[model samples]
Every structure is written in structure tokens, then in C-alpha cells.
Target chain A: MASYTERQAGSRLADYLSERAQVLSIALFFAICILFFSATTTTFLTTGNLLNVVRQAAPILIVAVAMTLVITTAGIDLSVGSLVALINALAAILMAAGLPWPVVVVLMLVAGGLIGGVQGWFISYQGIPAFIVTLAGLSILRGFALLLTEGYSIPIRDAAGFFWLGRGEVLGFPVPALLAILVAILGFIVMLHTQYGRQVVAVGSNMEAARRVGMPAKRVLASVYVVSGVASAIAGMLIAARLGSGSSNAAQGFELQVIAAVVLGGTSLMGGRASMTGTVLGTMTIAVIGNGLILMHISPFFTQIVTGTIILVAIWMNTRLFDRNWRFARRKPS
Target chain B: MMAAEAQATRGRGDAPLPPEPILRLRNIHKSFGSHEALRGVDLDIRPGECLGLIGDNAAGKSTLSKVISGTYIPDVGEIELNGRAVRFSTPSEARDLNIEMVYQDLSLCDHVDVVGNLFLGRELKRGPFLDQKRMLAQAETMLAALEIRIPRLTAKVEKLSGGQRQAIAIARAASFEPKILLMDEPTSALAVAEVEAVLGLINRVKARGVAVVLVTHRMQDLFRVCDRVAVMYEGTKVAERAIGETDLQELVDLIVGKGGH
Candidate 1:
């Protein structure tokens, strides 16, 4: 009988470690950051400061969850920051025009989805690259925000219920932070356990193979942007409610932060690999760096330089050091 | 054109009466731009029998298989599945009729785990969630049935050896319980032992009553598994022979267009 000699199965622990090398490395990096900050600044480890960090990181965390899905499909949404600004400004205008706050929130989310769908259509059905489509969206969406408010900040008045979503505490946790945690949990479940998540990964990994096997590859590709758009809308509304005002300047360069968080968490920019746990850690790490730097009486301008450097190093380690086949310890030849 | 017709008729006259063919291709033609990729070809695939399809490069062997697999719509002629004429506009439609093809590239997703790749398009789900446990169990059974051994079901496809990946692709296609299976150059890239394993797999599949079409340049493999052999040249099937009546030299000559009609 002809038989294929099976490869010697390595230790399951080794398999698990190699598979999660990137995530593990990111977690280590996050821990190191937390430790350094804790030691450098007395205020960094305080409960009040930690709560503040979560609150400030909420919007980026929420969007980073969606961006994880987008990047998993080997696609980038350059317009998320602009979309947040547009939604931020538009929500204030709708409330100013005397629309019910609840109604304005729903309308803004739908508008965001529609705009995202249009861009997705151009990218998926029209065969344009995602970077090109979203780059155009970045410019066009931000322009819309500027035009709607004439570059002026619009104040949202007398909506206590809407404000509660952004600032209210639930079980002693900040409302925005709680929402972000819930969103991250939902993202994790969808990515790991759902058929839709498998489709996204498959579409990213080998779209032609997915199509040949009867998957809705194009629809799956387009749907990620819609997810990102909806996430951006939620983040925008939260910001508007918290500040009691909307500005075209809200979340400037926010997309970069979200992408950086997702990448830092070990999601591949090339697509088909992602980690929600890593995304959460990445978001917190960046938030901590920014907060810790201020507590240490360092210049705010230096934060950007640190963030840029971290992104480069993280990606460098992701591709070079933590490649998919990387084993913690090489097995002896049997 | 006259020579092709004469050769096809001669080939048909020599064919033995057997069990009804699961799939029959008659006078099928396909064209790409001005190129006639398949010109007036005819073939039959019988249940529980392996049919070796051999030809030189660009001899319409791949095109004929693609037409049967519905990757290319035939410009003319008829496809009869179990005696009923059927038209396939898409590969999925052919798949719906229990026709499966394992392409030369294997068409397996590298990032997905073995079980996930096995259930790539038609995932088992319980209320929007993938039933991973069920899929894993089913994948184990599927691979075991084919006697293919892989150390891990959860390992990504990219982690497996070339032979293991080929086995997975073949196992996936075979597990569909298709009436007809088309394999295009399945052993072209395998090592010797892997080739032996694949050839054994073909025999097992034939025993299951599948109509197997094996397209290959390796003439020796044809004798090992195929019950009959068909030869194509310049978009037409020029000859067909029962395996016992032909040798490697005859097949090689037929493929290179040296066997006189």
C-alpha cells in the first residue's frame, strides 16, 4: 500500500506559540510601555488617570475594532478620520435644526453607511483599489465637514440623554469606555466565531479561491468598509456629545491612530490575520504613551515622534521577527 | 476539420460498450478570441472507471476539461449528464449537478485552517456562527476516509507540505460525493512517494463509482490507474484506446501527434 509518511507532529505548545507570536510580542511591548510609564510618572498608575486614559482612548478603540476587520481584508480605510469629522459636524447641525437628538444619531449612522457603500461600490464592483477610493474619500469627506460648518465649531445644546451616552458612568466605569469594551468584545466574537468573519479572512487571503469555492468574495470585501463607516459614526457622535459641540477639526489624524493600534496589536496590513485582544492592548499602549508623556512634563509634540517610531518598529518586527513560521525554540532533528 | 472528424469517428468505433457514462461530451467547441481552444471534441466518462486525458501542451486537453467543469462555456455542442442534456453557464451550476474539479493550482486558501479551507464556501453555521467543532469532526472523517494523514486539522494550509496540501484539495473534492471529478495535472509537482499516494487515491475514487477524468503528461501514471485513455491534438480528440490495448509509447506518440489516424 502506498502511503504518505506524515510529518512528525511538533509539540502543541510550540504550534500555539508560533501561531500567536505576533500577538504575544505586542502584549509584551504593551506591558513594557505600561511598566516604563508607571515607573517614570507617579500619576500614571493612579485609578483616576487610568479611567481618564480609557475615556480618551474610547473613540480610537471603537474605530480600531472596525479597522481591524478592514485591514484583515487587506484593505485600508483612509477616510475614517474624515468620516468621523463629517458625522461630528453633521450631527450638531441636525440637532441645531431642531431634529430630535435620537433621530439625528440614527440619520448620521445611515448616512455614514450610505457614503461607505458608495465608496465600497467603487472599490469592489468597479475594481478600483481601496487606497485610491478611500484616499479620495479622505479629501472629499473632510471637505464636506469644512463646507457644512464653514470651518466653524457647531454647539449641540440641551440634549442630556445624548450627552449621557458619552459621559454617563455605568457600574462605575466611564460610558464611552464601556461602549468601547462592548464593541471590542463584539468584534472579537464576530472575527473568531462567525461565518462572516471566515468569509472576510478568506476573501483577504485568496479572493480568487474564495470565489471559485462559491463565496461572495466581492460583497464581503465591500462590507468591511460599511463596518468601518458605522464605527466612525458612533465615535463621532460620542465625541460631539462629550464636548457639547462639533468641529471639522475633531479627530484630526485619528485614522492613523486607529490603524497604528490595529497594526500594533498584530493584525497584518497584508490581510487574512488579525487579533482583537492585540488591538485592545495596542490602543491602550498608545493611549498610555500619550498620557504618560504629559504626566512626565514632556513636550506634547514628542508624542507624535514616539508614535511614528513605534509603528515602524512594530511592523518591522511583525514581518521580520514574528513571521508565521517563527518558533520560540527550534526543535531538534529527530 | 475533415481529418479531425475522421479520427473522432474512428476512435468512437473502437470504444467498448460499458455502463452508461455519467457524463458525455459531444462535438464540443470553445473559442477564445480568434483561437479555437476546443474544436469538435467528443469524450465519455463512465462511473467506476478512470479516463486518462493526454495531449501535448495547447492540444486542447485543459480546455476540454475546463469546458466539462464549466469554467469555460462551450461555444457549441452538447453535454449529457446521465443521458440528459444540460447547459452549465457557471462552475457553481456544474458543482450543483455533482461535478467537481481539482485545479492545477489546488485553489486552497493559504491563511485558513485545513477544516476552514475544506468548508470554505459552504461553511456550517449555527445562527450566523461557524460551527467549528462540527466542521473539525467532519474534516477528520473526510480525510480519514481518503486515508490521508495530516498531523493537525487546525494548522493553516500554508503550514502543510505540498503533498499534504494536494491531498487536502483532492479530499475536499472527493468528499463532495460528486458523480464526476476532473483533476488537472494533480501529480505534476509531487515527489515519487506522493505520486504513488495520489495514484492510489485515484483508484480508490474510481472504486467509489465516480467518473474520473485524469489530465496528465505522465504516461506511466495512466497505466497504473486509468481504464481507458483519450488523446487530443490541435483541439480535437484524435484517438481513444482501452488501457490494456495501449502502451506508454503509443500514448506518447498520440499526444505528440505522431500516431497515424
Candidate 2:
């Protein structure tokens, strides 16, 4: 048999990326941003700031793992930020009301889980679109966070142990950051090593085919959201501890940032294939870009423009690469 | 064979038939509203014989195949299998009655392995978990019996050659222990060698006493495999002949509306 040459391999890669060209393009943008930041920013090259970016990206990076899984299945969750807020609000209220900090934390994680189940059910089992249901959840839960706060941040007046989750260092690195890495590692394991992870990607790739093969497609989608929900709550608690206050809007627009990170790290919005490594990189890229923008005295508006442009460029490149595969898929226009 | 021989000796009386042919068709008039697809078409698939279903473009060959597979229900028709009247609500329903349909797509999910595709939907389960080892062993036995050389049982179906894919499809169908296998253009996209491999596999399937109803556009293939030929044109089977009697040009005429004239 004749062999497939380098061109064949190249064409194959091109076709594979066509459906999700946005991921590759965003990855390229990450490289450009790293280059630009390193050339200009005095503090950008330092280990201290680089570590800071990684540390800051840690929590959002963890959540993006869930985001990647959800997105791979062509679903979206807008309630994560709100879920984080609500769980943290519960933890803050419980702790402030003189409950033991350990008890408050466990209750917060459980609150996140219960919230995940509800939102997951609505999105997966009820046949409701994830976007609408999760968006509704965002509004409803964010309101709960506000109600808990009474229009003010819930400041932990003396949260020494709880605050340590956010601020305390282990071997000179923040505890939350290390936990984030551990969770990310766990996320990778769950996605790769387990049958459930394979099933989720299979469902995301092709639901009809998945169903035909007897995979529990809906259940997998629900599980991803539940995981995201729990992770979001945990991140929220850490945020509250770090800031020493229960904030209703601590991570405003952070969902979009995490999504951007996943996309930048080469995750597909079309679902099926996810890259946890890409997501972590994406989170760090966002953190570095944001911090670099601040150091460069760039306006917030300019920062948005820069980020948006990079996303668009990444999308364009990704599409261009994928067009090569369209030859095989180009049917007679059924 | 003796029963059909006895019927021939009596006469071509076109009687109300005796003891209901293995499959009975009652003035099967199926239409697609204003445009009739089947157009009062009728067919009979006897037990343990290869039926070569041939037709021209827009001849409703695929449509009829789907009707048998329960992908489509005819507007008007009564299908009786084994002396019992039945209406198939779904393909699964038809499959339950020992009817299996194979198509060009093979309906195999490419991402999964061979055993996974073979046991898909109706996978053998030990309690709630999929019985992977049992399925693998059974799949291996079926493939080996068919004389197909696939190195990896764990290999993905997408990596399979056209012939290997066809073999897997047949293997899956036969594993279901179906009484009648409906094949729709199984050799259309096949390479030369692949086509021969499938033809041999078809023979092995027939030896198992399973009836095969194969639809084809290729006339040479009819001579190569089928024992009986049913020539369909514009939804009606206009010509029926033994495989030994029919020539390529004659078969083409029956298909394109010239041979019978």
C-alpha cells in the first residue's frame, strides 16, 4: 500500500481542527502575549510575578477544567460564578454566626454540590439548554449572595484559620495554589483514566452515536456541571477567605475569563476533546495579560480590546487550519 | 427446495397460495402521498435462500429495504412472518423478530473498538456493568468463524479497511443470531479485493442457514453470490429469475425497463 506523506498528515491535522479552529488560534495568541509581556514589562520576567500569575490562575484554572468538560459537550454553565458566590456567602454567614470554621467549610462544599445537582438536572435531564438554565441560576444565586450580605461585604473579623486557606503559604507558596494544582491533576486523572471521562467526551463528540453505543450521555453532561458546581463553591470559599470577606461579585466576568483560558489552551467549544493542560495555561495567560496590562498602565478598556482581539485572531487561525479537513466531509450538500 | 419444486409442477396458477409463503405480502400498496414510492409493490423473502434485490435509480430499493428494517412503515401493507401478522413500530421491534439490516454506513460508531461496536445498544451485561471480556470472546469467535483476519480485537472500527468493516457488520448481525439478514449495497464502496473478501463472508453466513437478501447495483456481483434474483424497477419487482438463467444485459433491461419487453 502507498503511504500517507507529510502532506497527508498535515491535511489530516487541518481537517481535525476545522470544527474548533478557535482553540488553536487562541493558543497562538498566548505565545504572542507572553512574548510581548516579556519584552516590555520590567516585572514580567521575574520568577516572583510569574509564580504570582500561576498562583492567581490556580482557582480559575481548576474551574476551567469543569468548563472544558462542559464546553466539550457543547454546553455552557453561567451559574459557576454565582455558585461560588452563594457557597462562600453561606460559609461567611455560618462562620460569622459563631459556627466552627471547619463545619462552615464542609457545609459550603455541600451547598455547592446541592446547587450543582439542581442546575445539572435542569440542564441535562430536563432537556433544558445549559446556557439558559445556568444563566437563570446565576441571576438567582447572585441575588442570594446579595441577600446574605445585606448590601455589604461579609468581612471575617478574625478568620485566622479560614483565611490561611487563601493566604497561608506551604513551602513559600500559597495553600490555595497548591490545592488548585492537586485538583487540576485530579481533573486530568478523572478525564483520562476513568470510563466516565471517556463517556463524557464520547457524548460531547456525538450524542446519537453515543446513545446508539449505550453510553449515558445526559448523565455525563450532568456530572460535568456537578463537578464544576462543587469546584466553583470551593473556589468561592477560598476567595472569601483570601479577601477576608464574602463577596457577591468577587469573580464578576470570571466565567468568561475561564472559558477564554480553556479556549486559549486549545479546548474546543464543539465538545468531545478537552485539554486540561491547555486550560491551566489559558488561566495563567489571562492572569499574566491582566497583570501585565496593569503594570503597563493600559486602561481597562484597552485591556478588554486586547483580549478580545487575541480571541478573534485565535478563532480565525483555528478556522483556517480546519478548512483543510472539509474536503473529506464536503458532501453533495444534502 | 422440494416444496418450491412441487409448486412449479402444479402450475403457475397465480392462486391465493398454500399455507402462507414463509413471508406473505397482501397486495402491498405503499405510497408517499401523491407520489407513490412502492406503488402496490409486493415481495416475498423465503427461508434459507439468498435473494438478489436489484433496481435502477429512484426505483425505491432503499425505501423498501427500510420498510423491512422498520426505518419506514409502508402506507398500506401487511407483513406476516412465520404465519403471524406483525407491524414493526421500530427497527428494534423488527430486529426482535429475527430481521437484521446492513447498510453502507454499517451503523458502527467509529470511535469505539470492535467488541464495543458489535455489542452496542444490546451489549451483554454482567449486572449493571458491560461484560467486556464476554463480548470480546464472543466477537473473536464470530470473526474467526467468518475467516476474517483482523489483528487487533481492541482496534477501532475507523481504522478498519472497507472489507474489514463489512466483515464486522456481518459479524455483528450474525451474532444477533438473526434469521434473515438484509444487506443494502454492502459492496458499493469496496475495493476489488475487499469485495471478494465480503463475497466469501456472505457465503459463510449462508452456510450457517441464515437467509440473506442483498440489494445491489452491480450485475456481476449477482452472478457471483445470489442463488435467486428479484429485479425491481420503479418500486415493483418486474422480473424474477434463477441466478443461473439471467444474463447481465437481461438483468440491465429488467432494471432500466427494456429486457421484459
Maximum-DockQ candidate? 1
Q: How accurate locally, in lDDT, is each candidate?
A: 0.88, 0.74
lDDT of 2 at A290: 87
Top lDDT prediction, candidate number? 1
Candidate number achieving the greatest TM-score relative to the actual structure? 1
True contacts kept of 2: 0.09
The positional error of residue A177 in candidate 2, measured at the CA in angstroms, is 2.6
Q: Compared with the true structure, what per-residue lDDT tens digits does model 1 show for residues A245-287?
A: 9999999889888888999998888888888999999999899
In candidate 2, what are the lDDT values of residues A1-334, reduced to their tens digit?
A: 9986543322555445653344455567678888998899888878788777766777788788888888878788888878887876778778889988888888877878788888889888899998899999989998988887876777776779998998888888878889899988887876654566667766776675565344666778788888888889888888888888887767777677777777677666666557776777677778789878977888866766666765665455435544322222334566
Give candidate 2's TM-score: 0.69
Fnat across every predicted model, in order: 0.67, 0.09
Clashing pairs in 2: A15-A325, A18-A322, A21-A318, A25-A314, A26-A314, A72-A271
DockQ for each candidate?
Answer: 0.61, 0.15
RMSD of each: 5.0, 7.4
What residue pairs are clashing in model 1? none
Writing each residue's lDDT as its tens digit, candidate 2 over B1-261 gives 343344334323432242234665555656777777787667777665577888888788878887887767878888888778988866777777788878656776555577776765576766645667888898888777766667677765766777778777767776677778888888887777667877776666766766788988877777666767887777787888866555677788788898745
Query: Residue A52 error for model 2, in Å?
Result: 2.2
